[model samples]
Target: MKFGGLQLLLAIALALAAGVLGAIAAGELRDTGQSQTLHHFVHEELDLTDRQKAQLNQLENNFAAERKDMEISLRAANSQLAAAMEDEHEYGPKVVSAIDEVHDRMGDLQKATVRHVFDMRALLDPQQQLRFDRQVASSLTSEPGE
Candidate 1:
């Protein structure tokens, strides 16, 4: 329950790093070209059959719908926390707790997203799965404007 100074510092540093990474990833996901990139990777790189592509699209749409409300709530909570943080007395702990709750919600969302993607991957052939993995790696490496 207790942490040394070094341990606490390291934990804070890692959390900050994760926050930065998540922000960057969220920005990338918001990109309009990302939709085209996903379609191209699925069609050409993974060589998903027409039916498979359709199924995948349907699955993604369902995920988007399912997560939409939760995402909005999380965003709103985050904004509230940020606003509250400007005040020291009335909202400090409340803002910190709200931020922590939002972080937990985001972590849950990430886990669900990974599970769904893995389920989709399971439907693909081995060669296609390899290609898909490579495509993801390539996408991660090739940042915006590069």
Candidate 2:
């Protein structure tokens, strides 16, 4: 009975760890794909005037810095989560709090990325905006590698 209980607890812990890691991996993959799609659409698909290009360059630079900071914070949150899991060896208050922090960081990064996308879209002309909108919608809706 003791052994069975320990095995069950180990299984549950493994499941929780897998869930957390999977969520993080999926988020990172989606973020990378979205970034690549947008970068390609803006730089290659859309025809931008010199002024628009300059403006976009500046926006990209600023967003890059912000994105880096958010990513760093997210990494830190993940580290905390790992520590909590290791120290507690099971789901506990510390683990729950760390998970929440990770989710919050992910949400912050996602919101900032969406805002940056909108800011870029704003610089486009009507026709460009139409194309950009379609691309953005498609990127968001499509499955990974689709």
RMSD (Cα, Å) for all candidates, in order, is 8.8, 4.8
Which number leads on lDDT?
2
Candidate 2 regions exceeding 4 Å error are: 1-36
lDDT of 2: 0.77
Which 10 consecutive residues of model 2 have the lowest summed lDDT?
A: 25-34
Best by TM-score: 2
Q: Model 1 over residues 50-107: C-alpha lDDT tens digits? A: 8887888888888788667656655665555544443332335865786677677677
C-alpha positional error of residue 65 in candidate 2 after TM-score superposition, expressed in Å: 0.3
True-structure RMSD for candidate 2: 4.8
Per-model tally of clashing residue pairs: 0, 0
Clashing pairs in 2: none
Error of 2 at 83 (Å): 0.9
